[model samples]
Target: MRQPSSSAPPPAESLDAVQAALGAEHAAIWVYGLVSAFLPEQFEAPVGEGTTAHRARRDTTERLLADAGQTPRPPEPAYVAPQPVTDQASALAVLVVAESDTAVAWRAVLERTDDKALRTSALEALTGAAVRATRWRRAAGETPAARAFPGQPA
Candidate 1:
């Protein structure tokens, strides 16, 4: 990738962190599309919401990278789920994992950046991921619907 203009001062570590989060968002959008097929009609609303949210975040993160003169990473053509999502149980399980991955990625951004605005945005994304994961867990009747410290490794 071409180096961003020196005047732009895009810190390599921070740019790398946001790029990782952007990739997670892309993967999330794709995962939601795939898992939606296995969800019930009642899940249509949340699924739609999740897809929309991820798209918005992805776009915003891309803009942030571009503003810093850094090239954003593109989405992959395909992603293999950690496991087969053939049923509602499996679908929810995969969704939870995807959302958790996003949370972790955003948290990495938070850790790498000193910019107040970027920190705020990363926190919002992280919180959103945590909430979405909790919702899926709730639907699956998993215990502890929310994590105490989301993005922290168990």
Candidate 2:
């Protein structure tokens, strides 16, 4: 990634971390779309909300990368789900996995950056994903829906 023209450009490692977060955002958006068909009409609102949230985050991440003089990585044509989403339960499970992945990526960005603004952004992203993951887990009837230490490796 090219350094920003500003005198206080973010470190390359931080930029790379942000890029990874951006990629996670892309995957989350894709997963949201993919799960729509498998979900019931009762899930329509939540699915739309999830798609909107991920799209907004993706746009913000792309802008951040552009401002840092890095070309944002494009999303893959498709993403493989953790398991077959043949029903609502499996679909919710995949959503939980997507949000967990997003949280992990944002946490990596937080660890790699000393930039206060970036840290704040990353923290918000991580928290949002963690909450979403919890919601999905609950919807899937998983016990202990809330993660005690979100973004930490199990």
Candidate 3:
């Protein structure tokens, strides 16, 4: 059986963590696309915002994967969503959870990396996911989803 990773300082200059972050970026792009379809036609503003965010993430991660000499894995045909999203309320819920998951994966890169630039990139990714999560939560009349991140709250 595989052992779990610890908080020990990561191996030097390995791009593995960054590669894993790219995979997460891929999944998030897929999720955002799926959720966008659930927005009402009158909510063009939110739909546009969501589409832009996902596209930027997908494009940037694809470039990072290429520049790092890694091939980004394509997302699977279907993913097991955390829950069913049959309406606006449920769709916002999915968006919130999916963004949180994306943040968690990007945070892993920050934990597992030594490259300064990669760490900064991971931080940016985390911030963006968090912001999107907050926006969706507000749209759904839910509390801000931000919480103690990278570690449990004290």
Candidate 4:
């Protein structure tokens, strides 16, 4: 009976979690691109920025997988968006939800890992998500929401 090796399972990323989170990140990257279709002309810059940020995180996640000697799973063909983003209003709503979900996913990673760098990255992602959510809410003609914020606390 052979025993399992003690390689520390790479450094961070609960593969189970990474599978789900990676899917989320991938979806977010895709959603950000589509969201622009529904955004107002005034929102192009901000939404573009958010899209770029998501793209950066997507790239970083890929690097994490490579460093761990694991190939990240491909994202599902599609994800169930919260609702149809047919206009600026719905686009903002979708953006908020996307950021919030991303934050939640990163928080789960934080719980599943002890790597300081990963922890820091998770915090960064979470904080960015919270900020984006607030911005999205404001963009959608709403007031700033509560302070609970999404994802793990700093």
Candidate 5:
């Protein structure tokens, strides 16, 4: 039998945490574009709001990383959606996933950081993601639209 590797887990340092958040923000922004494409015409307002929110968060995360002397990860020119998003239902599903994933990244940052301001920011990000995910779930007609713990895996 092959032995398992014994490398140490990656450290949860501030710079690394911020970079992870930045990556999540980038992904969220990109996914919002995909979401907008398949959303119904009536959902233009929500899609626009989601896109603007994600962009703002991405910019803030990049600034935070740069201020800490860390290079922020850039967004991919394009991303493959986890599922087919050819209809409104699938687009809402993808939006829920994107928000949930972003929440998880922010939660990780919250777990790793002791700084008060960073903790506050992480909390806000997590809460915002949870709210967005819930809205998307409701729009998708999914049951139990809200999770007790937003970032933790189901």
Candidate 6:
């Protein structure tokens, strides 16, 4: 993500939105870790990929906030999954929910920011989360795996 051009701080609304996105990224990393045990060995690659992607996004968000002189919010100790994740199917379902939440958060950032670089970064984050959610939905045998309007409320 690009740093703010001037020393002046980012807009308060934009900072808050980015902080929310950071929180979502934190929750996503936690979800990926929690689902590892429930997923089969064949699913290792995607799980690892998701974890890495979320971590990178999280780091970038933190740097952006810090550069703007705002302290980024820390992750919660634990997050409650939308559904219980006892088996492979439930695990995938929860992963879909996590990714969807991140997409929504990133989309909010896009709406709040007018900064060109910030908007570009937010769009990429939203798109990535949407794609990840679709993958999880497909793995769980969801009939319509792709959302018609990702980042929009269902």
Give one clash count per candidate, in the order shown: 0, 0, 0, 0, 0, 0
> TM-score winner among the candidates?
6
Computed on alpha carbons, the lDDT of every model, listed in order, comes to 0.93, 0.90, 0.70, 0.75, 0.83, 0.93
lDDT (Cα, tens digit) per residue for candidate 2, span 51-148: 99899989999998888778999998877887988988889989999999999999999999999988998999999999989988988889899999
Off by over 4 Å in 2: 1-7
Q: For residues 89-121, could you state the per-residue lDDT of candidate 3 as single tens digits?
A: 888888777777778778877777776776887
- Residue runs of model 5 more than 4 Å from their true location after superposition: 1-12
Off by over 4 Å in 3: 1-14, 150-154
**Model 2, 106: alpha-carbon shift in Å?**
0.3
Give the C-alpha miss distance for residue 69 in model 4, angstroms: 1.7
Q: Candidate 6 — which pairs collide? A: none
Compared with the true structure, model 5 gives a TM-score of: 0.89
Residue 21 displacement in candidate 5 (angstroms):
1.3
CA lDDT, candidate 2, residue 28 = 95
**Taking the tens digit of each residue's C-alpha lDDT, what string does model 6 give over 98-146?**
9999999999998998888999999999999999999999898897999
Residues 1-154, candidate 4, lDDT per residue (tens digit)? 4333534454444655655567678888878887888766888898888888887888888777766667887777767777987887777788878887888888888788876777788778778877888888876777656347577544
TM-score of each: 0.93, 0.93, 0.77, 0.84, 0.89, 0.94
Q: Write the per-residue lDDT of candidate 1 for residues 66-111, one digit (tens) a residue.
A: 8887788999987999999999999999999999999999999999
Model 2 scores a C-alpha lDDT of 0.90
The clash number for model 6 is 0
Candidate 1 backbone collisions, by pair: none
User: Residue 82 deviation, candidate 2, in Å?
Assistant: 1.7
Which candidate model has the greater TM-score, 4 or 5? 5
Sort the candidates on TM-score, descending order.
6, 2, 1, 5, 4, 3
Candidate 1 regions with alpha-carbon error over 4 angstroms: 1-10
TM-score computed on alpha carbons, candidate 1 = 0.93
